[model samples]
Target: MNTRSTSTFGHVALIVAHCAGMVDLVALPVWVGTLIQHYRLDPQQAGGLVTLFLIGAVLSSVFLASRFQRVKGRWVAAGGYAIAATCFGVLSQPLDVTTMAVLHAAGGLAAGAALSATHGTIARSANPHLKFAIVGVGLGVFAVLFLGTSPKAIAAAGGYMLFAIFGGVMLLAALVCAIGFPDPEREATDRQGAPVAAIPRAVWFGILGISAMALVQSMTFSFLERVGNDRGFSLNAITGVLVVLGFVNLLPAALAAFFEKRWSARSVLMVGPVLQALLAATIMMAPGFYAYAAAASVFAAVMIFTHTFAFGLMARLEPSGRAMAATPAMLMVGAAIGPVLGGTLVKTAGYGSLGLAALLIGSLAVLCMSRLPGHAPSSLAQEPA
Candidate 1:
């Protein structure tokens, strides 16, 4: 293939990765309500089912990251979709709670393989940061649209049918994967012909920072609705706030990209967590819906902006794609642990636990990020040309 063809393929892979990331192969809160209603699970049990999915994803991501070049990239990615599709197909059947958890865990493992492949493609891109931001925007758009539509569909079709529908979505992704990724032999030649670059020391810190960031976000996100209700907001109001967040989530790519050159990645990485913690505080302080709405909008924008830099920085940390390969694994690892922590904190600390958790977690993230470049540069004004 020529340069243009390779670039086109890479772009398609990025979009596919974005979609793979967006596809909730496991269905979180949406499935939470269904699991609770149908399976007679308590809130924590339903949430644990979500964590099971992440646990599987984390495990698979680690496994795939090591053998990324050894196998057929196309088949690995396509097969992951196929596997998730099969899991979803089985899940659509009537089953006991134990069976359902087992099936969801299977699906999560499949999703993680595809996610690692897709993120690897992004990491290998020429402009990884920009690509990462675009991927985030794509995910945000898809999440909003899916979240907006899925609730009603879950209401109408119920959980089993919805799982089947997602299975169909994965099947479509498999078709795209066939076209996007190179065949095994071609991939082997490319890997041998064009070697991946050396890794920077800073990449390791970026990895730790991204993982911690995920823990902070998921810890609160999984239980955000309960927190809102505890603060006196109605369920309908909280749903409305999320929908608005979906819309505003589109801002990250454009906003973050605009500032990335001017602001320097280091300072953005440091301050991003602080802003996230502040947003958590806003949710705690603002009891009224409108105030919460204001906070949520800004929060969505800031969170996306931060995530763009985090993923992009990791991609840039190593041209060898090792850092990027590990990206999804770290993310899922944090996500897997988040619910456990959130469950514990919400129980012990009350509605304000998310704020406290974010504060503490964000501080940890900040500390991890400080080791990277741009954090303590003299000033944007003082930099040499």
Candidate 2:
């Protein structure tokens, strides 16, 4: 095929891989609720299980990201998802908590490796922000379908069906990637053919900012269903909120893409955490259905919109793609703590405490974002070789 055709095909593969790898965005609520209701685990235990998965992802992504230049993206993407699919398939069987925990961690590790490869390739593309937004739009579409149907299906077929669906999605991603995942051009090298300089301190702070926001996102999101159910909202009502959330999810990435040149990335980054904290507060503390539904519906959009800009900024700051390759670690490191921390807070201090936690964490996010340099240096902005 021609270069244009190959590039288009690679974009498609990246979108599919992104949607498949980031299953937590669409599935976390159901995943946690299923464990609580069907598997008979407490909030902390259920959250801890999810935390283990995020921790595994973080560990693997951190390990692979630094070596992104040397690794083959196509094979890594194909192999990782295939292994993750197997882990999820096994998880579908009736198993003890210990076995399930091991499977969850293993699956997360495999999936994170694939995500690292996928994101590294995107960072190396001609337009990292636009590319990330395109994939985000794809994920939003997946969220709509997954949210609209998965609940009723799980209700009918049992919680194990969730794992089955997860396995199926991962398997599909593996197949697609194996057939056509693109190998982007490698990062720019020095005269000695060495990789570029280390990632800037400012970029690290930007990453930390995104990670903090992710923690807040996951903490509140993991309990969205439970919060509604506990407040006596009907299943249909909660599901309606989720469906609306999914539809809402479709807009942010497109909006981010549109606003890319218009808005300052730093300004967007600064506003995101504040909006995230406020929405999270409303979702957790609202006494009525409408208030909770409204807040919950648009909550995920904040992170989606903000992260697009942050992803672009990081790509600019560290053009080698090493920092972007660490995307899973940046996202999941905070996420690993969120569920368990949220659960502990809910169990001890009640849901209102989540609002307080969000405030504190969001402040830290703002602080980190504030530290980022206004622009990438000339040296860091050059295209990778």
Candidate 3:
């Protein structure tokens, strides 16, 4: 019954719960592909599903966490998992597009609340960068397993059934871990449920930086295969590049976690954006197979470094945790907008447009990082919230 005693279990449980919720966005391509085939729909029509999901996710992340952040953790976790499982089950049933959209939206709401609660808890850890890295690793492992099992599930039952089954499993696991979470009241110290505009100006800049980073990432990554083709890469070569890039993604988080004490968060924050711009330029200029492969690998590594630190910054920015709660929403919102932006660029010029766009976006992120309260030398890892 003691909150302090549950620290170890609470940490692990938060990681597990966050990963389960994150899988939806992390594996968007697979889910969207399956949906397109199942419904005989165009990419645009299927894409609307993602938009609705983000809308639900953003709404709940901001609304619920802001109001009830002081509520008990177990209640939030159990309630969220229960809601997600129920929605996924209903989502598997035969329904019109309108009906399906509503269920998906409900599922997103549950996921956002669950993710925010867990992530906000982790944000308070003694070493948030390390905890965030663990999140990245957990996601990587889940991605491999999800992809491996998904085909068989899809073949035997259907894509819809896969969601129901996974939802059930996640629900059970989350329920078991319900008692492990530490006190939400302590994790999220509400400023009497403060209004949105009450957030510090510096924190707003950090949020904007994170959103811009996500925008550049999704925009480039979404059409990477097409970019490879445009660069005259063979299909197998492109697959090889991405396969290696996948493994490369795991390293940065591990490295960042290990080096947490050694590096200043501000140093990492500033350096990361520059590296991102450089890597994006490499893919643009080199125009060779090996260059693309190398750039992709480096980009993956740099992202985890930046993403983890930026996330930690938000946690420190406001102990009320409202800013931290919006992370999932910001990421999804940026991702939802990226394709349209990238698509416009591609139509106007070529794949080179992505490089130019990244250059501009990365610059904006750097400028935003400058405004974060912790950007000063000594305040590197100190809590600014």
Candidate 4:
């Protein structure tokens, strides 16, 4: 194939990999009410399901990070999706709420595997810097916001069936990617199945950035959904808010090409939390719906920019294939923690507290961020300079 054609195919693989990672969380909001009604679960208990998923993810990342280093990237990706797919199929059955939560947790374990493995795959591929950005856009923006935000048939009798379909598609995509995409084993590791030893300080910083952002996001997004409902927003209106939020998220990444040249990665990482605190304050002070929407939009913009820029910065820090491959696994640590913190907060405090808590957390994250080592300009940033 021509270079352009190869690049196009590679981009397709990245998007597919991202979509697989995305299905784990995107449909969550849509299922929230249905899970409550069907399972007869209280708000706190229903929220626990998400917490359980996080627990499974955290444990999996801890244990499997090294083992994944020993295995072929394709196999890891395949196993994660297969397990997730099977769990989703089980969930489609008429089980008690407890059973459903357990099944979801099982799926979470699978998702953790897929997520770690796909990151490895992307990192080892040719021109991985571009691939990382693509993953951010495809998974972070399009798959997450578009497919995840789409209203599912959660309230319908065949809701479980819909979930099953969702799982099946993810599984199918994983399988196809595994089969069609080239193996990353050659690039990801040296002989004897060990990744290289060059660890970049900026990678650690990236992990810190990801962890902080995920926590604030979980707290705020979960809170916004619940509080908006409390404030008498219709489900349709809530959905509209989510859609707008997703679109707004695309803004920062869209302008990343411009910002990276002018600003340091540290600067980009710092913008998100500061903006989020401002937005959270706005939401707290504003009394009208339009004001709330505007706040949400600004928050989304900051988050997207932060996540994309930080991820790109991390990829630049690590030059070895496998070390870079492990970056996402490290980053997932934050992802796992975020939802659990948010769920616990919601259980204790009212939804209003979510924003307030995030504001404080964001402030602290900014302080911690100053201690992290800085990264040099990414290749993208160097181009056209």
On TM-score, the candidate that comes out on top is: 2
Name every residue pair that clashes in candidate 2: 188-385
For candidate 1, lDDT tens digit of each residue in 68-87? 65655677778888898898
Q: Write the per-residue lDDT of candidate 4 for residues 80-164, one digit (tens) a residue.
A: 7778778877877888767877886787777767666676655544444455656656644653344334444454454565566
Q: Which scores higher on lDDT, 1 or 2?
A: 2
Tens-digit lDDT string for candidate 3 (1-385) = 1134235676677767876767653455445545665666554555567556656766777776565456565667667877887887787777789988888788878877777777666665555556778877766666556644554566568667666765775686468557676654234333446353466778788878877777777666655655665677875675566556656666777777776667766677777877887787677667678878898656656766778877766655564566776777777666666655655666677768778888888899898887765433344344311
lDDT of each: 0.69, 0.89, 0.66, 0.60
Candidate 2 lDDT tens digits, 1-385: 0123236777889999999888887788888888998899988999999998899889999999988878888999999999999999999999999999999999999999999999998887766888899999999999999999988899899999999999999999999899889876543444237747878899999989989998998899999998898899998998999999999999999999999879988899999999999999999999999999999999999999999999987898887788999998999999989989988999999989999999999999999999876556666563422
Residue 57 miss distance in model 1 (angstroms): 1.2
Q: Which ten residues in a row have the lowest lDDT in candidate 3?
A: 376-385
TM-score on alpha carbons, each prediction: 0.85, 0.96, 0.79, 0.83
- Show the colliding residue pairs in model 4: none
Question: How do these models rank on lDDT, best leading?
Answer: 2, 1, 3, 4
Please say which candidate is ahead in lDDT: 2 or 3: 2
Sequence-dependent TM-score of model 1: 0.85
Ranked candidates (TM-score, high to low): 2, 1, 4, 3
What local lDDT score does residue 230 receive in model 4, on the 0 to 100 scale?
66
Flag the better candidate by TM-score, 2 or 3. Answer: 2
How far is 215's C-alpha from truth in model 2 (Å)? Answer: 0.5
